[model samples]
Target: MSAESKPLSGLRVLVPRGGTWGELVSKALREQGASTVIAPLVDFGHTSEEDKLVDALHRLEAGDFQWMTATSATVVDVLAHHQAVIPKHTEVAVVGEATLQAFEAAGYEVARTPQDGDNTTEGLLKVWPEIETDEVLKVLTLRSDVAKPVLTEGLISRGHDVTQVVAFRTVGVPASVHIREDVQSGRINALLIASPAIAREVAKQFPDIPENTIVACVGPHTHEAAIDSGVKHTAEHVESDMKHALIETVESVIDQSDMLD
Candidate 1:
């Protein structure tokens, strides 16, 4: 498509996370005529509880747990790094499309994903009881160091035996000087907030953002987190679509901005 015919033409958008997921989002944005800056705000590292994580993986391979939960793509990366295997008897569950895509890419067969498009822990929990026939199951819930125990706690409250393991620790990455300057000066037209951690990094790195710049968050929870973290956004002026459809969400916001202009 020609630049003038594109919806996001002349717009610059920031993609927070790196690796396979980042590349996919960046490619989608570029196709819509948006120039993307892939400055990853967070990186994953080995968890401090190495022994516990190893034991959990060993038991997972042994098919001790009836179900395994992966909340993020980073969890799938940790599993791939450990060369872990999901036995035939154990079912795999995930929260969002990104996690589902990561599992599929890693050659892991997922047995469950949110069907209602909620794509959050609450969404997964909502369908868990209906999909799972077993009354008492041993669930292995893998999560990041900073992740809340909402899934684990919900499972336990539902009378399931749960073993929650810290898969990896989230580490913050500093943005380059040029990227920081562009953001502060409003050279970048928009910023994408995929997670609360990335939102926190945005707040820490760029304390003062230009009011003209648009900040698009992937979901409702993320939008709340961004505002709570003092990340300036355009939500006040526009009714934005809250979905994990990152490219579509960006286009929706840009369209709103056009109408306002």
Candidate 2:
């Protein structure tokens, strides 16, 4: 437990992701002595193209792919739902801390998480593993239908065999009425946006956020998404990595907000 006199003592933060993601953010906030509101604003649904996903999973289990990749935990949820199995020989690469944690929690060992610090396709491409000359790696990428094809295209450009499959659908889940009202009324001091999808939901669900509310994003891409969604959160709210980065960024935001006061 954190000391009650921590920097974030009086803050009321809104964690807009659910499942383990929400739990992680909430726990981190609590550890910083901040109160958290776990109001999930988005949820996953079956992949739009289920048949294709199943076929890809079958190929993956048959060892037809050399490397399998997961960009989000929802992909793992899809695997759990279908009881999909990966051949022991097929290496797994995951992006993002949450996805990596979820992947490990599912009892799978990860082979790579791109050496580049950024958690984007560019990062994966920049540090795409070097394989032996005799082996042409066939890669399976689990993705959301709306996610950009940067990773697939990048892998293809590098001469790797890439099969990109949509494993889940991202859709908005309405926040509880009181949660929405609190954000609108400026009662929640800070809002944490872990993904572009969550940024879109926060923008849509709370179109008129109070100026004092700090809307923070997990990284550059999510920050860009917030901007694209007309989410008016200050440009200073992007953290590039995990728990420590998030906590540091949140504390900075709080300190700056105090300076303004």
Candidate 3:
């Protein structure tokens, strides 16, 4: 390493997930000389309205909707549970490549994937499927329980009939004692806030996070969520994609040795 290298040297960050994902993020941070603390702060739970979602899945298999929107990877798991089938003619709109990968993992094909980075209601709306006829589109939205009805509402305003179903719920998971202690003690230089719920949890659990620790969100929506969650410090958007957002944020803030006076 050059003398001016390792901008993130001495920086310790907290990444919210572990296992393969954690390892991947840790590897990236280690290259930047930042030690990463792997602790997942949230987990996906069953949708609040199981029966409604189950019936929606049945209708999906029956070709009731012309298009179905998958806002997150967890929706793919719901399809797996019901052994859902998508007719060849039915258009499946995925939020992003991650969601597309989830569908493929669950043995489904994606007909349309969001092209933009903000892979949610706004992104899907930008790549809205074309309708050849005057008939209103029949759309099914499978989303998280806490997810706002942005897509459904937007489609409705566009004169489409949408049947929105809750695919899953997000539950908060407590961080390990060592993790919390490190965070509060300000040893952690940054905190990667992946979701709105995670932002809320951080606000609740780690109220005394270091003043200089970076609080970075994946994209604009999550940035808003962090603001809404009332994180005491300013929150910033590091990248549109989750995979590289944390690393990008750390690089932006870390002190560069070459800049030393």
Clashes of each: 0, 0, 0
Instruction: Report the C-alpha lDDT of model 3 over 1-261, residue by residue, as the tens digit.
Output: 852366556666787754333455567677766777888887667877889988988888888898998766667666766777777678887664445666776667777655534544576677765633468999998888776777788888888889998787888888888888888788876787666777877888888777666776554556677788777663342332333545474333221110010
Residue-level lDDT for 225 in candidate 1? 78
| Strongest candidate by lDDT | 1
Show the colliding residue pairs in model 1: none
lDDT of 2: 0.72
Q: Lowest summed-lDDT stretch of 10 residues in model 3?
A: 252-261
lDDT of 1 at 235: 46
Q: Which stretches of candidate 3 lie over 4 Å from their true place?
A: 1-10, 17-35, 81-89, 116-120, 132-135, 217-261
The TM-scores, one per candidate, come to 0.78, 0.78, 0.71
Per-residue lDDT of model 1, residues 1-261, tens digit only? 798777667778888877666766777787777889999888898999899999999999998998998777778789889998889889898775567777889887988766655666777787776335557889999988877777888888888889999888888899999999999988987888777778889999988888777777655666677889999765453543222234474433222111110
Q: Which pairs of residues collide in model 2?
A: none
For candidate 1, what is the lDDT?
A: 0.76
lDDT of each: 0.76, 0.72, 0.67
TM-score of 3: 0.71
What lDDT score is found at residue 20 in candidate 2? Answer: 58
